[model samples]
Target chain A: MIKPELLVTPTSVENVEEVIDAGADAVMIGEERYGLRLAGEFDRTAVHEAVKLAHERGVKVYVAMNALFHNDTLPELPDYLAFLDKIGADAVVFGDPAVLMNAKQYAPKVELHWNTETTATNWYTANYWGRKGSARAVLARELNMDSVIEIKENAEVAIEVQVHGMTCMFQSKRTLVGNYMEFQGKDLGVEGRSKDRTLVLHDPERDVKYPIWEDWNGTHIMSPKDMCIIDELDELIDAEIDSFKIDGVLKDGAYIRDMTGLYRQAIDQYAAKPEEYIEEKEAWRDRALALQPDNRELDTGFFFKETVY
Target chain B: MRTEVKETAAADKRVITKKPELLAPAGNLEKLKIAVHYGADAVFIGGRDFGLRSNADNFSIQEMEEAVEFADRYGAEIYVTTNIFAHNENMEGLDVYLREIEAAGVRGIIVADPMIIETCKRVAPTLEVHLSTQQSLSNWQAVQFWKDEGLDRVVLAREVGMNEMLEMKRNVDIEIETFIHGAMCISYSGRCTLSNHMTARDSNRGGCCQSCRWDYFLYEDREDANAESGNALFAEEDAPFAMSPKDLNLVQSIPKLVDAGIDSLKVEGRMKSIHYVATVVSVYRKVIDAYCADPDNFTIDPEWLKELEKCANRPTAPAFFENTPGYEEQMFRNHKQKTPFDFSGLVLDYDADTGMVTLQQRNHFRPGDTVEFFGPEIERFSMTVGTIWDDEGNEIDAARHPLQVVTFKTDQPVYVHNMMRKEL
Candidate 1:
């Protein structure tokens, strides 16, 4: 069971079935109303349909409503949660304390999963949130496996770790694109190249490029490569991590299917013959590489970093 | 020690709003003292461990004790930051560190990690906890939630607009704190990982190399069939939007901030100089006092903006307080910082008998040069640099070298640490 319940990011309702069929045990959806990945979220009807499809296949559906909200907007949350409750969302993933507190009050029946953006970098936070009635917490992707194992050893709450994804290095509420384009004498998310998602960024001295995108809300400076830890499944299993999540909510169903299929095969192969996992590692890597999206490059992410400092 | 722990509830729904405390950043002990001297009601600082400002000359335990005593004399509060998003390795000494600072008479602790907040409840139960801007508490519910969790104050996110802050005051009865001045983070405070990825320096844990402020340019994606490896690499020279944001100056908005029931106005600079600490603190202090005294007749003193401009390293912008800052306000072309004002000297002890004030020159100055001596009490007083005595008590025409201690005859008395800036 520690091999991780393969989780897939199903951005739209139409992709839910593909994600499940591709062998994902769970589906994470970003609702259009809340959460960070607003560009890749499902509307009310879409999320309801997605949740229904996942549930029919015995796959869990987690709704991402992690957007930081103000008091004026918080009053409307209970109604949204009630809608999620009616649709039977397996869990509500969020990143704000108010969201956690409000979810407890309004939608107690819906399992609350605190996203890592809440700064759950240590065991204490997970256990603290567990005590506060949150069902699970996502471990910060910043933490390496050594730290992850240490957290899992002491934490009371069930924890999920991102095994593969487009890691966001920076996300801000300030719409830098919109504001910058206005300076360029253009509109934000409108007109020319300002709206284009391929606006790559480079470190002042470093020649390497990182992808950047801006929407109505804000900007995200993402990693140039997607994080792929298919080879590190053994380490996560050894750490007893609750789930392995693959992030790319804005990606299409084919992306979800390919990623989900690779992880599914990796998990199964490791399960059947644990000793052969290491020897077959490169073989599995090749299999995943064959299915890897042309736009994305893959690396181990923070899995091998050993230490944060 | 005065804690900011007002009960988050009152009979009238609004918490008994005191005049918002003028909080300043203290990179080190000198800066801490300068902040208090310049009319800061409370000062937030980082210790050598667990604080986010890795580059700053952070306080040691000995310095924390001294700083707490210094702040206490002026009836001001001291908040220590141990706000790192701790990994398993960083958590071991955290309780002991918290207890040590608490024993040092720190009035409060600013923390972003909830585990640290929970730890504070257990380890230093008497001390107040201020939720750092890193927590990104944008709404009143978030403020209320932290208050419910036993936090004394919530430093709301910079992205939070004026209306939201005001709404938080009306609904959320916590001590709401916001950055009224200083640097604006391009990413949500404490949420950035650009430094971590680019330099292996964790932004949350402190080694933020400030990758957001780095220069960058955009290029379109490569064509799928013959995708070149390096074509997306610098299709242009500079990004129109990706430059570091200008430093935030909210001194003009003090009246409106006060009207919105803010409990504290914080200036964000721990890695700043003592001169910067003094000038910024003094300006905000004056603005806060002026507004509180005559809220109805309040008008932004034009001189305050001029004073802020002199102190600032980057162009000043109002941030999201008025609205989302426009391109004109947020974006900058040249990323390098500029120092237009010369902080020439620090005011040393004054000798009434000889009518001479002892001073240490930070920058060079000439004999008979008019230098402005400004501090908490004295806003602006120009005095001619008369006969200057060197460190060995030799009279010289000019204080020719930086950091040279010189004594000069003065008609008006000057307080210690009063900045002497010769306009450059």
Candidate 2:
């Protein structure tokens, strides 16, 4: 089985070295203006420093600029793309074509990764954008294992899959939290918009609480369970996926480091000796579960589901 | 009212190169015919497979052929939806499905999946590829990306505002379609998975449970030290949270839309009733024609809005058109939509000599109830029901049975497919 690159999202430029030491082959960082629900915002100076530090350690830096850009935001992409290019970022993760257009003109050297959140389900679309210039496609988390393997085999571009962390269940451009407060005739202002407020939505019919928050972009509701695929690493690596992404958005530095270290051990052990790793798979799963937040459950997301719709 | 609109429009004599195409939804073969009869320039329908509206009474290949033929006679085009975000499993028989719809004489296909788009382009070369709004095309460069790839048209995302659309038009030469009226998804189309996560229904694959409209109790994280110590702070009684957006209504913006050279104006609802399809399509049709006839002197008829209210389930607003919507655009307290009228019946036939109008009953309507009769060709007029005869010619006081064939006397003539509705 080929070893897949373990991609971990870092909380800051200062956190880059820590995650790399924890065994990250690549680090993804972005500014809040362009990225949606990023772990932390890195300014232009920080981006340059992060790239230099990651490259020195034989690691790659992927910049996140994947917001659905409106007319007001599209014009700012050119300069940002140029800066990423100047700093030699490995790729610019994007969902909007405006980013692709601006990158082509301003930073032709930077690689493009098609990550349209939910639309990149099959290989043909991946290849479609691959033909246009995307170097990789992030498969939608809604896909099952069979679909992922099929896409990995057929797509001309590299395939990246999210193997850990909270999954966004819904994102709306409307400031739902702020609107609720206003509708209530209460002005919580900063408290209402702050992501640190730890807001959640509880459906009365179900005994689950979905984490909800508001940021500069809009409202985001997260799933009740964090996707922990420690045991499934062997399957993805055996399938020869290009990259294994561990999203650290809304997570603490300790969580990112622990997850990166565990996934790294699993991926390495599996590659080194598949039989030995198989024997110890349950132990690895337990260790990962022990690290998970008490409030959040852990599941394989849609990977093991027999059916989705 | 028609004469009055023309009189107001006569003052402005500017000519547009083309009047925008009026697109409507067709949940079934009947809705297809009704939309065309009511003046839809194009009608989008979902075939039995690979569309996002699985619950709709979608068309089969045979029915699609019939719909295409009927629409052709009226010079209206038919576009079938193969717009599901397809998985590898959904890819089976898709090439054959594309060819089948093409052979059925579908003018185009609405698709979001790249495989479907590429397959349609390869196997069904004759069918135009209209990118579904599920892609959330908010900028011109994205439109240009598809245009460069050889797709024919792009349906602007509901979140794309008017200024953004105009910018896109200035930048791209491809056909542009905008949703003039419909229910708005609070999240960007195809970006939401609340339904998939909440109810095991893949909204991208068309089994949407609409979990965003579900009532929920809001609370701060209980694990936080500052979290309210008791249920008093985050109880369901503190007003349940809902993110359901009001429906989009752009009737008043018809002149601007026409003047902007938008290629098509679409109404969104495949699962809507026949009455809804007719009323919405006809109102847009009337407003578009009036504005295009005289751009400068055009004014929206208040009656058109009133007619829309009869079928409106949710309150309507011009969402994301003029500006980013605010608190007013969402319904947080309650999600259920209410309409002021009930669709009473559909006209089956009219005997002019005997002054008899036969109706197919939909909802309960009794004798002495005043109902309005409106058709594609006739002016709307109210008639007081006097005496009714059942299919057997027995006089009945009320037409309570669904789809019951009943007859009434009216001096005015009516045609088949004409609708009757009563105030609720």
- Which candidate leads in TM-score? 2
lDDT of 1 by residue, A1-309 (tens): 456788778756767787788899988876545777542568888888887788888999888887767666677798888888878888998887777877777777899988855277888888888887788889877778887888889988887988887777777777665566666665543544332446665443665556666654477777767788888788788777888888864456687778888889888878888878878888877877776767667888877764343
Interface RMSD after interface superposition, each candidate: 3.2, 2.4
Comparing only chain B with the true structure, the TM-scores of all models are 0.91, 0.94
Range of the 10 consecutive residues with the lowest summed lDDT in candidate 2 chain B: B1-10
Task: Report per-candidate DockQ.
Answer: 0.55, 0.65
lDDT of 2 at B196: 83
Question: What's each prediction's TM-score?
Answer: 0.93, 0.96
lDDT measured at residue B179 in model 1 versus the true structure, 0 to 100: 90
Off-target runs (Cα >4 Å) in candidate 1 are A1-3, A187-196, A306-309, B1-17, B223-241
Q: Report the lDDT tens digits of candidate 2 across residue range A259-291.
A: 899999999899999999999989998999988
Q: Model 2: which docking level applies? A: medium
Q: Residue-wise lDDT of candidate 1 within B349-385, one digit each (tens)?
A: 8877777888988999988788888876565888777
